[model samples]
Target: MVDAAQKEQLIFVTQKSLRMNRKKHFSESRCLQLFAEILTVDSGLKPAFLFDYCLSNAEQIQEYVQELQQTGLLSENLHILSMQENVLIINLNRIIQHLERALQENGVQVIDVSVHRENPQLAETWVTKQVRAQVDIIWKHLKSQVIQTGESKPGLVTASEIFSSEWNLCTMFGFLLGFPASYWFDFNTSFENCLSMTPLRAFSVSAFCPRITKNLKHRMYSFSVPDILYLDLQSAIKTWQRELQSDFQTQTMFSHLCVSTESVCLSAVML
Candidate 1:
């Protein structure tokens, strides 16, 4: 019922549709692969993962995250906090537990109250206030309801439920990320950081595949240490590198990718 020209047009259209579908599949697969790598790295070393680059839109992220969950790549306790500006994946239990540890270990301070300071009490007061403020911010959002049982117990609250503002989220995340020395400031009082003008040395590690697809040759992981503190933290950084190499070698998904680290000096403000 069709002429030769019409049949050729139909075949061309079918081929084009197939190509488009294939391209879409590759893109979605790449995104998922990247996310899986993040999960694997964070599961062992960090309580949260802050993705600096925008990989996919919100809708796609939700869909991909769900797929990841179904495939057992994402754990039930881990949550996706935000997908707007950047992707924030957090382990709710770990964050809460870390906060408790900070409270217990520091007593009245986490950064330490200097003995040589002109006002040691003043420093202690400020440090305690800042730490408690962060604790309050997290608890305020996780409100408890009284039931007929008459006893109050905490419920499992996701980070997305507890944090509405990005600033507050950042405040909480700073503690849970497991940096050797995390800077803490009261977000309610000020957003300024003590390391504002300092130089930050960023160590970036990536899983590289030379023969991989053009769009996805590298999956990177990076964190920064203040340049002044690098000497004290060099051993910690070495430990991290060793762990990364071990993970890359043991994980079957990363079998094709070789891990490498690159260090560079960056301005603190740029982060």
Candidate 2:
């Protein structure tokens, strides 16, 4: 439940939200910061999962909200989609207040809402300023944490490796800090590439995808090839999406699903 201090910010949620809502101000990382601060403000609340369209389960989100609205858990007028441009904001304070009163009447104790209200302007200021700054700080540190390589390394580094290294860093950070990354860089989601979007990644699949497929298909016969499949960006992204909300597993081989793990795994199998 949300606190009573945030009602003024509800001004942002309007009839305009009845149409398609485009969420411009809050990205996933930004939402993470907002939720994290809320957690800080009230120590008792824990975030479960927040659904947004940018997430992989776009279809599931649609159905879940429809269910909630149909069951009267949510309003039919509620803005269901976060379009990253026009969006609806909820009045957390009032909603919690109503819920608390209803529950108390039914003898179900609820989380204590803070009677002391704070300036809602402060939340606005924090969202506009600090959230971006915090994301920058995290992104900067992640850039540094990547495992460095030299000219002596095997293949010439592709742009994907350089980019996904940050993803790897974020993966490690979330594992260490007990939080998962909410939004990822947009490029990772693309089925195409900067090289004119010529289906270049899929084309590359013909290069090494076969051997790995062969190994997996025939591994039962102990006739596996001694090669590894550096899952292209597409496959890696699909894997990451499936595991998006999962706890970071320290023992999971190639948790980031980048090429380096493919290299290591093949080398180890050969050895």
TM-score for all predictions? 0.50, 0.17
lDDT of each: 0.45, 0.24
Relative to the true structure, candidate 1 reaches a TM of 0.50
Task: Count clashing pairs, candidate 1.
Answer: 0
- Deviation in angstroms for 158 in model 2? 33
Q: Cα lDDT for residue 162, model 1?
A: 39
Model 2 Cα shift for residue 246 (angstroms): 1.6
lDDT of 2 by residue, 1-271 (tens): 2222222222122111211234443443333233332222122111112322243333333343333333322221221222232121122222233223322333111111111212001123333233334434433433332222122232211111122232323222221121211111123443221222111111101011121122111100011111212232234334433443242232121122212122112211110
Residue lDDT tens for model 1, 72-129: 4444344555523655655555544545555555522233213232211223465557
